[model samples]
Target: KSKFGTDLNEVPREISFCSHTITGNKAHVVPDLSKDSRFVDHPLVVSGPLARFYAGVPLVTADGYGVGAVCVLDTVPREIAPAQLSGLEAIARQIMSHLNSRNLLESERQLSTQLSQSKRQLDDFFDLATDFLGICDINGHFIKISHSFLKVLGYSEREFIYKPFTDLLHPEDVEQTINGFISLESGVQLGLSNRLRAKNGRYVPLSWNLSSNVDGLVYAVARDMTKQYELEKNLIQAKEKAEAAASAKSRFLANMSHEIRTPMNGIIGMTSLLKGSIDDEVNIERLNIIQSSGDTLLELIDDILDFSKLEVDKIEIEKQALSVRETIQDVIGLLGTKASQKDIAVKYIQSKSVPAWILGDVTRFRQILLNLLSNALKFTERGSVEISSDATPTDDGQWTLTFAVKDTGIGISQENIAKLFTAFTQEDASTTRRFGGSGLGLAICKGLCEKMGGRIWVESYLGQGSCFTFTFNALETTASTEGRKKDPFAQIPTDLGSVKPLRILVAEDNRTNQIVISSLLKKVGYTPVLVFNGAEALELLEKECFDVILMDCHMPVLDGFQTSKAILQKFSDNRRPYIIALTASTQKVDIDLCFSSGMDGFLSKPITVNPLFTALDEVYSKIHDQVPSDRPIGIDKNVSLTRKQSKKQD
Candidate 1:
């Protein structure tokens, strides 16, 4: 603007000289634009810088897209010397060169501005991020930590940097945190929760998001999880407390069950002993009622305890040889009286395909059948309850035994059938009231069936009846369950009076129980020397030899378990008496304990004549086996023969 007369910097593209020159590949020279038809009507030519002399060249980039142009314009037409004209062209090239250089400088300035802004944004993000950002070396040492890290954990950069990341973690978390570094290079990892020790020596839970930087560094963003962790801890503690309360309740139930059964054993035993002596019909009828009531109470107790055990996963099913036919027949025999009274005939159907014996839990197996059959009988007024079993052999040397209990009774609606096997749910309220049951039998059966690798279901229609079926997979056993199980009283005389009485030591503490047990022994023609506890029994055994020792598992001073162990250790095997454990505990663990502790036999109490007689019979049979056939029978009269057998073999 200083050198030229005026400036047309604001001119429109229509009459712009720079725009016209940009269309040409090189300089355009017009001595007078008004003489050219293209610019004759142009505004700049006709109105302002009129009759212009123009010399212009395009401002071309390196890629050759012309953005603008530089030109010299004069108000009047002019002619120059040839030398001056050539000089002007050279000057125009120089102008283009300057224009290119100016554009380059301007682009560099824009790029510099962009880079500065980008850096500012990145720095802002790094310092102000909500997550605790950090960079660690491959060795897990902190190289740099964001201000958020210091803010979140209350640690200064000097105090945190260069220290191992694991050093800041909770002691228990160190190993796991360190292990994460080795494989982190594979990909980004996030949302891993860990406990970190803060500067103030308090634990801060952090959920981390991490990734591997191409340059041997670990980048991490950690979110504070202390509150979430505390909530989870509270939930866990509540769960633990609930579990503890449940465990205590179970313990109380088991103890109470043991405690209650002890007295009931005495009562049932006394009742059994007195039943035959009572001649009055009314007294006999009353005794029957008492026994039935006691039995029902026993069933209820058993159901409650069994269900509790199942709930706790404490029930263990044994894998052993079991007889399906015999087990079913036995159930039928036990329930025969009830079935006869109701005039509902029961039948057992078995296909020849079913194996004689299979490996399974015999107790649970029988329980399943008993529950289904008993349920069938309760519903059926007069129709038959048919229990059938058939098995299909499996590829793994096993058999799938499908059992069904079909019955005719007030059939369940489709909706109610689903509720049948659930605990405390029977057909209906009226049915439960009239039929009389705890409604836990089928639930227990279902639990037992599932535990034994089987499933149970029912098919029924209204007014028609119900058929309850279950399938069990069992491994074939070479030995028969019945053949291997000998009748304990088959060889022994049940009339204890007929057989000569053996010298017996009864370890019992309760006064009433002592008299009752002694009376029963006396009635059976055996004189028992009763000791108050295991210590008393031990003391008595030191001085005298007895043919049999009836030990109560739980007593005041030194229970039966300890006493039996002491007796076995003290006496030579050949001289040891046949020890039988008398316990009110029908728990499998307790029975297993009795046998494992080397008792000759187990007799669960409220001891009826049958159990007592069976224990005695088994004891005698075991003694007979222990006695060496080669040795003189008198050498070891009625005790386990020692391995040495010094009296005879030596």
Candidate 2:
């Protein structure tokens, strides 16, 4: 508010309202007030009054509360008409109305101030958050943004505001940006994730949520997902690579099994023939050598099969009663010769507290012991190897069996220990050369231990010794099961009666195995009719009957599977011959082929007499009646069975 004035320092009491207030009259209203007696007589008004004639009305709050007044002043006052007074009064009322509006506006202004302060605090909090926050307009321009958005995006406030949201979008996500904004404008609340171009021009994966505010504003929050996305992608690629490698390995194993078994079959076969014909002492010693070679071949096959099972993660454990004392004896019996060869004392630390029979997977438990003992024997030269066990109760009322294998061998160094459990990795490359093994034993043991709800680890010192420890659940065996009879496979032969003579037919493409199989068969009174391949076997079946067909699955012309199928078709109703498929293919599908082609049994190569006999006994009844008087015989080294037997003999 301003006062009307005239000459320098002129003051008046009575002031004109309309003219002074509206036109900002400084001299006219003030000088008029100075001439008036009432105003002139007044001391303050007479003393060069800047306010000559003043008029004002009290301003009121919106709630009718009076706060202050607005006044209009002039320097002079003179006689005035009723119309002018009415005009003055009207102008006074108008001024009062303006004052009331100002009060209401002031109240609103205070409220606005408080709101602005609260919004700033909220903005500060959102800016401090790690997650990105932003506001965009209908035109896709950024209206507001948080500090994190700047930190994560490497942008400043001036750089971000009024900039199109799509300007920061990755080229691949441009369409997605357009779609998202279109959806927001169409009243759609969208939560999306994609890549965005950062200030550094690198694309970063981001996840975000967007919603419309009451004022038609879009609020968005985002999080950087670049690292997480990359990790998941790498994991998927790794999984695929592993699966492919495993598939290739399985195929290679199947092929190797076939290749090894073909030659082994001939060696064992020819040894059988030699046993029936030769009776010299020298021949007997030769027979022992042949049998030992066959055993070695069989052991190699077993290791490969075990490795295959471990590779595919299919080793299953079935719990049953097993004799601890007998298992220890069995391990000692099997590995004793190997230890003796190295002059290593191998023994078990038998505890009196150990139950004679315990419930566990006999096969797996035996395997564990075998792996540990084998490693000890291979690594140790002069010191003793000890296997011991201790039993305790767990918190869950289960028994815990802790087993340890301590060996005083060429101990593992710390460097080797770090990679000990990795497949195909030994203490050193020389370890593989010195100790012949695939280096998969410990890895297989670890996997088996984990599957059985346990863990295995080792402690060793270079040149001192090594101690391998593992824990497993100690299962309780019922008295009836504990005292159960030993399985037939577990029984050692007092005489050769357990070894049965076999009348077999071998269909294979390899020559050495045919000779081996022929000798081995003759020794055991197994009259084997040899065929070079599956096609020849089919032709032979038409003329002579065989007790069992040890049909090699991989062959030229008609495969073993097709021959088996043809044999079944030829005798669909009659007493079908027991067809035992012999192949190196250990894949489940390959094994299934035997069954699908009407095979009565399946024996994977290199076939040991144990599994072969088991299969024969399961399928054939007359196998025991045709025993030959001859003993085990030496295989002919020069005979290659791949040369057709029928033509060569003729």
Candidate 3:
């Protein structure tokens, strides 16, 4: 009564009804406190503000403790009702609940203020980061951006926050961003990479490291990659240009080979015929010199062509059944002439260990042997150059044929040996001057060995000599070596003079080539119908029945392809003559084109009498269905068929 709450400040606890109500189970009621002896001596009851009636209720807690009392006092005597007492008890319980709730709310407000301060500091740290940092909501809306984003993209936080993250993505990059977010999962690191639109209207490439899944917030560290992207694009363009240049160089070398070989073919072919006819030893020896010089030139051209092909990755190893013994013998025979000029002992020891036939790239096999032998001859002044072969069978039904070419040559130094196999590099500049070469022979051999699933290496001493060893993987074959090996290395059957004459037609544009071919045909006893171009040849074919036609691939008017197509279309299968291609090109593509254009036989020119007669005999025998009595064609005892004859194939 004296203050806001009803607590008697001066009342003695012994006399106050609240004190009694604290002990009582229900509200302690006194109809007249002044008339009752229980309160007559109380100061509050008999003195100032004396109470005549009093009603009190105990404020008991749920655990049964009476913490306080609720009381009503009246100056006049009154009666307490049960209803009013019960209502007072309910109000006391409600007040205790309100106090408890207020205390809890005050504690919570303090914690919330502390948390807000910490978050504000964290956000400031993110804004100060140098990397492009960002926070996005679970729905992919931009929530916060670092100051670095402003530096990188020229955009303020206010301009991007609350906008969909897709808004800044380049049109082409939107799908990638969407995919990255969709794949995002708890603890899974799915990185994001895309182009974002800058304020300057240019697309800026960015790489992002993101961690967002469980926190319902996307946290990302982004890096500017625009410069990196530009560099990569430039590098790709430079690579393309380099490849194009290499291709152009390869084509140039190929064209040069074709041009050179066309004339050299005539020289070699004529020398071969002259060597065959002359019985005088002196004259034959002179012709052999001319033949050797021509072959050396041809080999130089081959090396150039091979280097170009390898530089541009045009050459590939083709696997087929091959004669292992024949490969060694042929290589030895090929270099015998050069070795004989120096009087070096050239020996080939074929190990009885390897199979007679095996599957491998025969051309590459021969090439590797030839290269090593040539290197040996170039280095050695005298003594022996020896080649040997053996094979080890593997559990996988294959064999590793190992060949070693050991020579008594000026040996290579350890320091210089490593430099030998590098393209266009030799041991020293003097080595190049002493031995005229492209420096591609050993490199080409190494590449060939690798292409055949093997490797090449050398063991040598500074003065003792060098030995080159290489291995090739091959499958064992049951094929007979009889099909490959025969008596002569390079021979025309002298009995070719006995072949029955047949009607022939010749088409050539070059005057010198025309004369040479006609003279050779006359020497063989066949009078050939001659013409200058394909159009004239076609006119002759329409007017007469010819058993065979020697068609030149390239001529002035109506090239061979067009003429052949015209004749094949006009004539029936039975009436059409056997079309044989006579051209200078030795490339496989040119031969393939000839066959595709209806050619039945191919003979590369500066054709010797043997291959020329062999080509004629092949067509003649096939047409007549009878083996000719004179001799067989394409027979070489030492030559590996892996390197098919450049001049003839039926």
Candidate 4:
């Protein structure tokens, strides 16, 4: 043996003894390299730690390939023992086997790590998923269930495994669940919606999509529909409650209108009768004040009713031919007296481009103008109030007409202008007190303007003046007014002496209303047969023929609607009198009911002289086939009562 580092032990292949050993699949032993001709002068043999003897065995793999050699060398010449050399070969073979085993073990460890990571990812997905994911067998038994499925059902994994899927369903849903599974068996994908029973005995709605594979396994995903179902149910209930409240409100308004207008009819009617009989100018002025107050009260009631109708979107706009100029002029004329009293000048500026006739609701158009003009006059103490109208043609062959009511009135503040179109709201609390109004006029105008497919707005300074502007769309129409007659009430014929007399009957339940209506009929040159109720009127018709029956609704014994139907049934069309419903109810439904009951015409109360005369004039013209001529007419002497007698009856 020689003392040398491991680097010296590593010899070149040509000089190394082990290199020679690897040439054959066996051991090679040299007793003395100096004696061997092949390696006698080799570097290992001549070097500082010269090896004189050597022994080596080839490291052969199992495949019989000689890769490299294991060897031993010595400085002195020596011979290796045959047993020791055989043992060296055995050790080399063992080393090769160990290396192959280590490589196999390393490959197995890497594969195992990859498999573990994949399984963990799958577990996390199943645990974190919101949807219920599961697998079932052909028999509808749950084979595997995700954590989400177990959590929603409030069940343990053991409780769900191998359990029939239908067992977790609501009793009512079990049949459908089974049917849906059956459908899945036929290769048809199934969508199943049903309720599932939870651990607490509560049913939870679930919507599932399921499909079956060739391996007899059902893959399913489900969503809990509990929250969605609850929201839908709540929305439906809220809608029903809102509708019920609206219906209740409508009924209340109808009843209130009937109750209030019935008495208002009497107050207004009596005031009109009293004004006509008064002789003293001072007394007449007092009557005028009473009449004006009555009219104002009626207007307030109408405003509230109109606002209510608009709030519910119940008011309908009538599209008919109407003169824009005439409507504006009419409003200004009606408010002119008020303007004069307030020391305010009122005027109308009509643009030449403005259409003479357009399709719109005349009554509502007049109402808007009236509200703005009246509001202008009420707020203005001294300055002029002006109404101006202009028109622009739209692409749709319609005119977009803009109307502005400008007044040098107490102007609205910037903040107050926003609240002007809000119902029951004004510039301030003091505004309502100082200027007597319900504050619904502008609000009503806004609603009406929008309903006509237009808008309303205002421009003003706090201390200067206000200009309230509104626009509405209307189509220009060539409607003719050639055959239109003058207002019938403008000059009622005082006498029907030359013409056949109209046998008129008046049915009224209220005593005050009876006196008022009888007096109004007498003033119109007709002596009407006054009856307290519809039944009395019907009884009179049996004995005597009448041309007209002014039937008041809400009468005792039988109502006007019922009486009208009965009268129509009892008499032929030609023999039956023209039935006119005298109703205090101003609701469209009540008015519609009047016509539905076979009444020919409607007269809303408190019945004034003009409307009364107009109704009679229509009747007179229809019966005579011509307008009535001027003739001296007088009330029946028997029916006419003295002022003292009327006061006594009252």
Which candidate has the top score in TM-score?
A: 4
Q: Model 3: how large is the Cα RMSD against the reference?
A: 9.6
What TM value does model 4 have? 0.70
* Per-residue lDDT of candidate 2, residues 1-650 (tens digit): 44443333323424433333334322123336556664556554667444456554444444654443444455454444556655655665677677768878999999999999999898887867888888888667888888887887788899889988687788888888788877887777899987777789888889989887657788888898978888999999999999888877777777777777667766665554555466797996698579667866766576666667776775566677777778867887778778888888877776665666677777778778888887888788888999888777678755677788999988999888989988778899888888788887888788778777788999999998899998788666754333323332233232222354344788977667665545444444456788988779877877776656777788888888888888877853233456667766655666656667766556666555456555554433333323221211111111111111111100
Q: Rate the local accuracy (lDDT) of all candidates.
A: 0.75, 0.68, 0.76, 0.78
Error of 2 at 478 (Å): 6.6
Against the hidden reference, what TM-scores do the models get? 0.68, 0.61, 0.69, 0.70
Candidate 1 Cα deviation (angstroms), residue 242: 4.1
Which clashing pairs does model 1 show? 265-606, 574-642
Angstrom error of the Cα, residue 156, model 4: value is 3.3
Q: How many backbone clashes does candidate 2 have?
A: 52
List, residue by residue over 73-162, the lDDT tens digit for candidate 4.
778898787788889878777877886798789999999998999889877877888998888886778877789878878999998889
- List the candidate numbers ranked by TM-score, top first: 4, 3, 1, 2
The TM-score measured for candidate 1 stands at: 0.68
**Candidate 3, 446-514: lDDT as tens digits:** 888887888999999888899999998888887753354232213444334456556788887876667
- Supply candidate 1's per-residue lDDT for 160: 86
Query: Tens-digit lDDT track for model 1 on 1-650?
Result: 11355654466777676677888757678888889888888887768546578776665767887766655678888765567656656765676687778988999999999999997887788798877888888787888778887887888889888988687788888777777777786665644778888888888888887788788788888888877778999999999999999778777776777777777777776776667576788987787778767776777787888888888776777777877888899889878889999999999999999999888888788777878888888889988999888999888888999999999987888989889889988878998889888888988888888887888888999889999899879988877523532322244354574564467889888776787778777776678899989999888888887867888888887988888889889987667676777776656556667766767666766666656755554454445554342221111122332223322211
Q: In terms of lDDT, which candidate is strongest?
A: 4
